[model samples]
Target: MRRSPWATLAVLAFAQFIVVLDVTIVNVALPDIQTDLHFSAENLQWVISAYTLLFGGFLLLGGRMADLLGSRRVFVIGLALFGAMSLLAGLATSPGMLIGARAVQGLGGALLSPAALSILTVTFPHGRQRNIAMGVWGGLAGLGGTLGVVAGGLLVDSLDWRWVFFVNVPIVAVITVITPVFVRHVAAARAGDRAFDAAGAALGTTGLLAVVYGVVRAEPAGWSSPEVIGFLAAGVILLAAFVRVEARAKAPLVPLGLFRSRALSTSSIALGLNGAAFLSMFFLTSLYLQQVRGDSALAAGVHFLPMGGAAIAAAVLSTPLIQRFGTQRVQLGGAALGVAGLFLLMTADAHGGYATALLPGLLLFGTGIIGVGVPAQISAVVDVQRHEAGAASGVVTAFYQVGGALGLAIVTTLSLSRTNAAVAEGASHQQSLVDGFHRGLLIAAIVAAVNIAVTLASPQLTPDAELIAEAAAVA
Candidate 1:
């Protein structure tokens, strides 16, 4: 069947929007969930971390599944599974049930993200067409992320916090019913020869989970404690084994050779840093609004609208700017904006006013993120073969999520440590929380500076130049 390329882009972009939205939609609902389910303080972060960990952990495997099976089949199955899990999460009567359901939903999202991207990568086939489509795809991912907090705030306020999960129903239903009909399917590449990498999947998934578990738990349990040390050690060891297995496997889940590309390698590195900066800020800002300033969930979400709004504007503008100036400039400029933003955020205090203190930083960070995200995505896929596009896309996405998890863990740990010291000085709870947030934003600034430096080192590639290469290569 002849497929409409515009329809395909719309479908894939919609899928990405939904997947990214789920990441932050729960943040505004966290306090409500905690109270309703009576969750312990220590485990509340798990509401976020669990989804990220499992999603990041199994992402490579999911991408490989798309390669070995069909993208359409995997996409449909993933959407169905995700929708079911979302329903289960909404209906949960206990904390354990909710967390478990979230984890499963993450797994399904893991499967969906790469397949959607791969479909876009192959379907678009690189040029002005692909560039504009991908820019929109990346933009929507950014937009949905911003919108999640805002939507979560509104939803949690108007109805129950559970509606955050329940709202996926109609969106999922539309995607599931329409996707197969509109989106062209890519058949498995190595249908006969590819055997599932059971051992590799087990090792990689468990290894990442162990590392994330250790890091997330480090804040509550002191880093030197036996449990923290043991988990970190085990995580490192298991991850080492996973790499070894991948190197030796007949049908490796992840092809290490993909890293040989400077574009992909540097891009992924920047992606990790960007993820750290983006996710950690969201975590800290959400807390600052609710815990420190005593804002309601809806109000907190509304406060983030400025940041999100700025980010969307910047992202939409980035494609043309990159076309004119170059990818490297856009990225480096974005990172610089982020650094300034974080520096501004460092001035945030318990008594800090949003207009004078937070708004400027949010705007700068939003603009910078748009600059960084779009070019980094371009670099990640630019040099890859069409056949390897699925795996390449997945690896980048995995790093992005892993970076977020690690960034959150690191920032949260630093926040806790600083909070402890402030508390020792007899600071009030809110004041201590604000102090910790200040310290965390300082760390975020450093990461953004590094990104700016690295992005400056990347090569220039304009959209027309890329399209020229696409034409020549096709001929």
Candidate 2:
């Protein structure tokens, strides 16, 4: 049966949307989750970190699996696991159960997201078709995070917090039923043709998980603490081992040579920096709106509507901008805007009203997000070989996840340290919190500025007309 390319895109995009949405949806429901689960303040953070650590850790392996096992097969399997875990999460009566379910949910996302993206890369021809498809995919990726906040608010207010997890069941059910009908399966690699680098996979996955775990733990434990230092050192050693293994392996899990592509490496770095700033923006602003401004969860979500709208608009504009100015220029421009937005946010004060102070910064930050995000995503895979698309996508996604974790840890630690100092000096609690948030916003601005510099310095940002032509020809 012939399947429409657009139909394939729809199925893939929907899957990506839900996967990304799950990342942020839990944020708004955290309070309720803690209350119901009787979670300690320290343990509460695991509800999120558990999911993130596994997701980032397994992403590369997931991408390779997509290539080895077939993208459609991996996608279906991932969706099934994600849906089942969502059910487990929603029915959980204790912190242990919910956190355990969340960890598996992250694994499902790791598999589903890359497979879905690899499918899109194959299904759509390069040039205008791929660009447009990526525009929609990138736009949805941004929208999903924003929408999760809104949806989480509504669901938590009207129903129970568990609805946030339960909501996935119906959506996943619909997508799962329709996916096989519209998405064509790519042929899996022959078993005899290539060796599966199990050693490389183990080293890389453990390395990433160790790094993410260390970063997450650093939020509660100081960076110099034994646990943080030990995990981080272990991560670095394991990753180094993985690189050595890849160089000698008959069939390496990650082709280290892919880093030679200036486009892929530079864009991956810029994306990581952007992820750090953008994800932290979401985290800081949500805290600012609720903690400092005294807004309810619902109100905070509503306030973000402007930012979401701005992001959607910027995403729509990204394709045309890329065509006219090229991906590099657009990305640099986006990073600049992000820096400007962060600067504006840093000016926020406890006394200021949301409309007066928060709205403009949110709008600019949101716009900046799509500007950097869409171009970075497109550039990550644009020059890669078709067969390596899954690996390329995984590298990009891994950077985004790890960058967010690392960046948030750094920013949060700095902010909280400052806040504690202020409180010790007898500052009001609200003022101290606001001051800390501003400090974090300042660091976020610096990160965005660094991204701009990186983007500007990369020669691969130049348009490759021949590459696009070759891709289209092959398609």
> Which lDDT values do the candidates have, in the order given?
0.81, 0.80
The most accurate candidate by TM-score is 1
Model 1: residues with Cα > 4 Å off, grouped in runs: 1-12, 120-136, 183-186, 323-325, 384-390, 456-475
TM-score of each: 0.89, 0.87
Candidate 1 residue lDDT tens string, 274-310: 9888888888888788888888889998888998888
**Tens digits of lDDT, candidate 2, 1-475:** 8999998988888888988898888777776787899986445556776677678767777777887899999999999999999999999999999999998999899889878877887898867888678667766776798798888888888898899999999999999999989999887888876567778867876787687668656656878999999999999999999899999988776778989988788878888888788767777777677667877677777888898899888977876777778888898888888888888888889878777788888899889977887777777777788766656767777777767766765676677777777889999999998888888898888988998887876654444555433322221
**Worst 10-residue stretch by lDDT in candidate 1?**
466-475
Question: What 10-residue stretch in candidate 2 is worst by lDDT?
Answer: 466-475
User: Over 4 Å off in model 2, which ranges?
Assistant: 1-8, 34-46, 93-96, 118-139, 180-186, 219-221, 383-390, 460-475
Candidate 1 local distance difference test against the native: 0.81
